[model samples]
Target chain A: MNKSLSMLENHPHIWRAREQSQQEERFSLGFDQLDEALNGGISTSGVIRIRTLTGIGELSLFKHVISKQRTHKMIAFVNPPGDIQAPWLATFGIDVKQVLIVKPSTEKESLWATEQCLKSTACHCVILWSNGVNTKESRRLQVAATHNDALCLLFTRPNRNSMHNSAALQTLPISLDLCLNYRQHALEVSVLKQRHGWPKDSIAIHNDWTPNNRAIKWAVEHNKVKRHVLHSVS
Target chain B: MLWAYLYFHQITLDTHEKASLSVGNNSRYDTKNEARHKRTGESANGQHQPGKTQTPAVIVYCEKTNHIVQRNNGALQQGIEIGHGLAQAGALCPQVCIIPFSEEDERLTLVQLAHRLYPFVSDIVIDTHNTLAIRLDNLVHYYGGHKELWSTITHELNLSKVSYHFATAWSIEAARILALNGVDNYECDRDNIKHRLSQCSLSLTALDKKTKEALTRVGIRHVHQLLAMPVHELGRRFDNNTISYLTALRGETFPHVTLFRPAEHFEHFTLLPFDVENTQHLTPFMEKLLGYLAHYLRARNLQTSTLCFQIDFREHPSTQLEIKSALPQSTVDSWLSLLTLRIENEVLPEPAVSITLRCDNFETIEGSNGDFFSNRFNEVAQKQLIGRLNAKLGEECTFQPKVSDTHQFETMSNAEISSSISASTFTSDIVPTFLFDTPKPLTQSTKVCFGPVRLHSEWWHETPRKRDYFIAQTLYGVRMLIFKDEDNQWWAQGLFS
Candidate 1:
């Protein structure tokens, strides 16, 4: 309506406080710390990097978010560390049949599989766990994900030294980067890089394995006495 | 030199009819079988019960005929002979299956017969459209004698299930004349062969109508009379071609026989003009090889699934590389994609020398069915992705995760995922995010966060195992599914990713 408002809408680099219709659809991670740290959670597409080791709260963190992606489409796991347990996927209320696993022997093949899945219209999301992805590979993955508007979450195992520090010296156009850590046997996650928001502090979720177990104190109290005793005879 | 002539009069028509009938075995083709049974004059199926009453006379339709060109014995029995018009044959026999013929199919049938007899006889000539002449002069010693060679040839022809009329004489032309004259017996003795050849009519000698009519007008209708005439005397009436034919047929002179060489896939080996360092420059050579391959595929009308090339080097052992297409393909483009993908990665150990390209199996091109009303989700693209993965990576590498109602985690993911997952109902028990391909022995000390859920193999299974499972977080905060077996050995199975 106004001259200033028209120029503001026309400007390419300007960020606007538009209506909900103009805003990208955000999927809440179902965890307050992750949603708040990710600034209204992740979208349906774009590259998100998770810098973590093999086993952490990464799967449980995005359990609810991944299920919200199109159910008719597929979710591909490229070079996953292990067999994606169907029962575990079932626990998240996602269709187990919608999961496709491509186990490429080499990192080059893993990147190819990731790009193929991202480019395919049938696949909605891709979870990649190749350690060889760098700035170029991450950018390539981002471009491939941008085609057909699919989500790609790359899980890179950070260096032993870099895992502790929030290394923000990045070189890729990554939307979000979260590093998972453990503190006193509880999972703590913090944002290493964010596209349009400030990186947030680490948040501690108190579930060790099962909910409300308080396993750190219980293991110290119970595991010490019965370390070597056998439970029952066959 | 002794020669044997094998004449397959019904090979082309029989093969054509059998091909269409066996392709689908429609009920409509049942009449063709009845015709063949009565034509072969054998009731192998016992369906020739009414004797030729309902047998359809099988005749070869001459595209638009002034004449009926070919016929089976039952057609002749019905008085619908060769040279009779279609109108005449139709009037004679109401139930007739007039099959059209082609020279290409006839040549292929002849080559197939030659292929069957190639191993037994060394010097066999594809003499004519329906006749094959085998030179027993040199091959008789190899197979012990003429009788053995003749018997082997007959045995092979019988095994091919083709109706063949064969005759042996001193020469190919004499043998052919005797064969077409119905002297289809293994007569190896020279006198008996001469007697049979002398009795053969001039009609079976492949002479033109004018020459035969002139010879017949002079009361010389048999081979004995033609052989009795002097070449110069016959030359006064007949041309030099007929004179040469008479001389050759009488065994006075030997005829040149071009021995048949079995067909092989066209192969090419090209040597580089100079030692090319980079593989990029060698595309010219690869182009030449692929061009030849395309011509070969087109010429033979064949589709091949696998192609290979042997790359020679200056010093290193020649490397053999194989390229495969996802489907049987005849075009050069389909193979070029795989070829570029294969050759781009191949690092030649030494400088180039030459390349030998080949197709091991030439598969006949088959028809493909296309879907007109497919869904909008781009299933073809999805399938192409799968096929590319199968071609580049391995087919076994891609899989869809499925859930089976089994306590043994190994067998659960292997089962194909059905549409309705009613077999799986998520329980409240703690489940790990990722299951290890194989369980490893637990060496590190870990704290169990949750308790023992007893899981074991079925009692009927071999080597049944029992274990108490727990959700354990490692010292580094990696949550895993661990178990203590009946042997009291601790093992880590998987992780909560």
Candidate 2:
């Protein structure tokens, strides 16, 4: 057998293995601890589900991901819970002009709009608010988000007490599932599901209120004294 | 200095017929008769109605005198002649249709023709009469040669079924003279301009009737005979105006005509062969007009921010639809897509007889510097998305979110997005990504994370607010911006990651 012919035969086999590994590559979430726990930040080809209570910093975390990425593509918000406050988003270093908000009137429309935005080359990240979306729609969105090298972040309320497993917990389709809850003045993020990695214990990120904290403390003390005097007079 | 003059013969009559053809298969004679009956309140009696016997007929009207000016072959056979009054023509040939002349439609038709020819030639001069003289020297090579260019022009005219007389010469004045004198097709070369123009009759010159009669009395029947006279003697006899006219006619001097400058705004209208009942049928026409508009914009290096479509109905008044873009666009495909979206959403009130597309809002595009990795493609893609979304949903729906400088959560505004956000205005602040419309009351179990910021203002309100804001964490492991009012009521205002 000729040495060159044998090497050529092995070339395609090597290329196929490399291509398979490339498909499994992940995108860093810009948090080293979170990335370490998830093996990578999240797979670039699958959906990331964050199940939490309504007012926790889920949107802020998504904004963190967007601001950290170097891409210039737009970030789309589909069926947000309320009117997106531009000033609030700007405070997080997320460009307000680069954000596109779609307020769909119905659940079907919300799903459609999200799918369209996810597939469009115009959007690099699509943040969807999924409250009552069915499992079928979630699977469809997961496929669309993974079709290109864009990120799809799904935020939903936690189904903590459901007897049947929720879509967020069912890891058949999603690449990563995170459960975020606030505890003891900190944000606690725990990996509930990972495609090819072990789940790590919850990581606590301490909240920093700074500069404003002193003013709030002073105001609280001042208000307490005023309330005491008013109560005594009454 | 090669110039081409196009004369639309019987423009008024042709426009009327074309308008009739657009509305339906009914002839212009029938529509005019019907209109006349409606105005005069004359019932369609057997004797009052023309064409009752199904015979070929013609009717010409004089606008100034409101009478018949000329008769066609059919009416001539029936003893109707020039200068016959409307009633007199009708009595003479009871079967001939007499319709009033519409000078407005004629003028509009001429303008439409000029717009169609503007792309081929830049220097177009429309005379008081229905003649359009265009400088064709620059365009001959583009169309392969003089013959090819003339053939292309004639082909377009034939497609529109327009009756025109075409003549070319070294000067616009000579071309206009030859075209107005019923020259269907003629071109004068540089060396033959004098000899060819000399053969033209004196009636074709720009001289007044009195001057023409005086020349004829002096036995000067041909332009060559007039040119034979000494220039000084001719000027002494007929004044300097005639001498200058002859100079221009002989191609010795350029014609002193007002050079036609296209309007800053664009308007192109076409009469449809049949009434369009649905918008889908108008796609081809709309696409062609958009192509013309794109060419016009590209020629001037301009782009339009807005476009309007006016749909003229056969019976009812026309309706107008306006389409706007988020950014200046000169691409035909972008405009066509937007137009398609709008047309799909629109329902016509009546069948359309004609359509006029107009755009007035234009902007000059600044040339972008080319780079190996420029963000131009991304910017274009983003604009395309905005255009599509706005076309489908509506304007003001797709917007960029910006932070407002206010302490109240509800008062934070989301302004409509334009082309781009100013980079200098983006500053980092300590605010959450999602702010609730109305803050939610928090339970006592919610733990305080970090905040105790005090925001107290709006004293002018009926109930001034005094609140202490906090960065709190809920049991669900989410960070929130919580505030407590003076009443000691705690509410969650926004979310943090």
Candidate 3:
């Protein structure tokens, strides 16, 4: 016997209305800057590709938003467990209760687990390590995530030579690496692509790590040594 | 336990918008009449007794459901906030609360509840993704046979405000058919099986009738009529295994059901994407995974005795490995520490692809009444230290017995070789403490920092060469790691990390 018929045959109106509403409402992260940049903070209901350079603070940005979520959200880290730095997360002020993690064995297993999580209503967000994700695999995950109204964040380490464009076609709205600066321990963020409005102007963010004594002292000493060398060269 | 599966008919705000008073604070609705008109049961002061008022309260009715699903509150379904039906319900009605019908939530709740309840039953098998089958034979007696179990289940559903339909039969197929057909209650016995089949509307396909003439020949007018035929003659007259199926459905023969699967290790975890570097991003996920693995093992009366870590680069296509313990233990701490160690020892050529901790060996563990002792058994400090090291290095750099192959180092092998222990089955076989397959040169003068240690293996092999290995330091202050070739030449390997 088909179970779906028993579940849906009697409630055509409800099922249809839910389907329609889910389609009409585009989900957002509620962060105006990031939301505007990526159509709306990663489609609340689809797989989203967010790419960044290796050294840039892309992971930090994703974590900051995910950490304080009051809503029930599950995040699956496809990246190797050690790749993410835990201490850096506390600095961003993320809460511990609202998130869940899943570590899959291989890339194939990782994708499978991710797809399973996306299909589950228990999870609100699925963040994947998209280092080797192809367009087809990415699309498959996006479809699964969207079907369940869960958001998918692809933390991509882009090719050093080529700009990553998988998200451009997969997501209705897209945000590309505009630009970021790690200057004197400070971070400045810029938007390169915006599917919504004129992208926000470049914003400067203070690096909390820089304010610590050890980091500050190290920066000061390093700068002094560089200055002395420059003077001697002149 | 008395069980009742109930669905709430209606609940809404327009009825109570005027209820401005807080639970103990001032009132929003001016008079009791306004509150009485709403479909909901209570008045602003919380003093209104149910079933005492002249008119019922308005409650939200589930628009999706039909049939006996709506036990009460039909009037609230219309725009009427205060309906007469709702006012009569008991404050804690077995059926009145608003329970969201989410498939995800239902599945999650079922799994979690099942985990907690396994000890009470002989076995419990959950069919996930709607395809996996579960056999309930052994568990039948534990729940006090079919009648007692179904009644107990019905009681639980009433408490949770959930509605479900189920049955017990000789075959899983028959049970599934009965449950899906809205036949909520059942007792699978020899005498009642035919009566149940007779009550069902069996289509031609369900009965496997070839054509209208074939169906009429047996005078099998209805599903029940066909079920009365003899099994052997029915098969001879018809095609395929239809007769066998009929017999099974009638309880003459028992059908096979899928066996329950128990996890080797369990985990329960949640993860959120924080900034890339914070390893804590994985803590919740780790915790959840461990919980699932633990619970899975417990269901099978087993425990994970050994674990291995698989760490990947987030940005690059490289993998690292780490080994945690020689012995098996089922706890979050052990899994976490092994993960940490793997993380520290390996370097991500890129950030990280993903991290996985797999516990392969499970030892039978007696069910313990209290979990408090298990929580205190593992060390948090060791796990934390391992996690730190993993964050600084990579997950793969650390090596343990299970994850790493204990193969002899050969001439072609690098300093770090994947372990072969995965394929080796010798539980007690002891090989040499160290076996180097790659023989170094007997002599080298690049800067002899340390003396040579002679090495030999596979003495039976005809082409085996006797060689000396030296740990060296170069004049440039760089450690000149050189190996002597069997031909008497020296090759220098790079400085280690």
Candidate 4:
């Protein structure tokens, strides 16, 4: 019985329902409802695909998660849709030294750079803003992310002239596929697919989550006051 | 100090041999040369007679003396001697390639060899263009002993594939003289060196011809005979220079060299044994050049951000290709990948006879005494990733973004108009991460989530701008940074992405 227990403990492929533990460390989404719906939260490593139109609260949805990944210093931006301003990244508590911007001349180079950044140990988060990625390229990126134990986020904008079909997106070797949309004062997030899990219906996050907005400051103040009250009572 | 000296007997001839031997294997586009080859009664396929291909056709001729100063093994086997003229070389080996001896070229080859041995022996002096003297007293301990140090030196020299004669002695002069005269031995004991030094002819010493002849007249032919004479008598008979020379050779006085300090920057020039035209034919030479650079950087514990390659052709103007990196990089594989990519895009105007690698800036990193094979990512791996990207895409394509000091935003993301106004005009707080290159016309019916804030450019600007910016959301909840220009027209500035 002890030998079998040791084997179960050592093997990464085996999952235990009683322990409520994951194969890899999971990062909380900072929302109670969202965390429950997604089983625990986002994974610590592996590829995550986000499909949405530009200019919504797409990046803001993950801004909290990016700052949470403090294990490795670098956060690469490969072929971002636009210039990711230094002050903006700083506003989100990202150090200027941690930002590596790569503007590849071609789509192939963009894919290559994404893979290279995912494999580099100095980088904890690699955000690639690609028009689209094929199944083969996504598989390579996933492997690189797993080897370095870092998060690789592939951001794609769905539009009229989309290159790949829904079939290609379905077969991508990714841990999660989340679609984001911004509605008045809320973000509509729906889990399209997740590893070893079921798809979830869309949920409107009623809280204001826009970066550089008043809600973030309000939340900070609220947390400070709550901490002070608890300390005074103790 | 115990010193080891190396004499490159014929570096020029050896290099020439290696070049010719490699380029002769398969050349397909030489019909014009074939006509000339027929006139010279040679094979059209570049193949030599069964036994005649033993060495590269090499001869270094001195125009001043009208004689062959050096010859390769092929020329030696063909019975050409040192005093042979062009006519004699032609008669001995009809296919022998004769090149005029150049003092500058020979000196460059010597300096290149010295660079290879710099890491092994720190205190070294380029005694002459063709000879080097290295102080091994300090390095002997690091390498375990004199034998091990000598083995390391010989190992590096053998990699260069040059004909060299080396010896170790109590003094630099003795070692140099012994090496130049082909007294090849590794017994570095002081007594053994002195015994060998005693047998060298007086003519092998650096003494002036007038002094050597004068000493010969007195029957002092060998070193031992010269040493047997009284110093006072010798000083009385010889000039001050001769006595100092004797004192230095005897180890009583030391000669100081400028010390071959590996230069702050790297500059290595390689002359091909044969002119090469195709890109495929040049990778080997480039690899060898980069190998030398890698060794050079490792010895000095240096990293370079930018390095250039200069290619010289026979008639066309030479061109240079410069490869730059965002971070200081030092490694053979990293630089080779970048150089090969750059060479792929470059078009050679003419066949290149020589190539020179030059680096102007070097950063000396600290605490570099680490593992040679560790692959953990750090500054090295980061630089490698950036370097590969820059080489394939372009240099400016990869960079760390920095905010402009002016703080004024651009109408478009990439096309930032630098001549902007003060930072005080844009402090309203709600800004977006992504901006359009040019303001797009607002086609969507939007709801204003924030108030209109007035914005203006510097008054001194040629086209001063006045606008009202607002944070707005469209019907689909896609938030945008929009503005109203002086024309009362609405435009979308950027995305909240």
Q: Return the top candidate by TM-score.
A: 4
lDDT agreement of model 4 with the native: 0.75
CA-based DockQ, model 2:
0.28
Ranking by TM-score: 4, 2, 1, 3
Q: Per-residue alpha-carbon lDDT of model 1 for A1-234, expressed as tens digits? A: 699989888897655435233367787877777777666788667888887878877766777667875665778888988877777777767787678789999999999988888887778888888766678778888888876678888888866665544433354676778778887867788787776666776777765335334665677887776445586443
Better of 2 and 4 by TM-score: 4
TM-score of chain B taken alone, candidate 3: 0.38
TM-score of every model versus the real structure: 0.43, 0.47, 0.29, 0.50
> Would candidate 1 be rated incorrect, acceptable, medium or high by CAPRI criteria?
acceptable
TM-score of chain B of each: 0.49, 0.54, 0.38, 0.65
Output the number of the lDDT-best candidate: 4
Question: Chain A TM-scores, all candidates?
Answer: 0.76, 0.74, 0.57, 0.76
TM-score for model 3? 0.29
Candidate scoring better on TM-score of 3 and 4: 4
Error of 1 at B3 (Å): 56
Scored against the native two-chain complex, candidate 1 gets a DockQ of: 0.31
Cα lDDT tens digits for candidate 1, B296-366: 67666677888888888768898888888877776666677777877898787877756778777888754
Would you list the C-alpha lDDT of every candidate in the order shown?
0.73, 0.70, 0.45, 0.75
Candidate 4 wrong stretches, greater than 4 Å? A1-234, B18-53, B277-284, B294-305, B313-318, B324-351, B363-497
Candidate 4 docks at the CAPRI level of incorrect
Question: Could you tell me which 10 consecutive residues in candidate 1 chain B have the lowest summed lDDT?
Answer: B367-376
What's model 4's lDDT at A130? 84
DockQ leader: 1
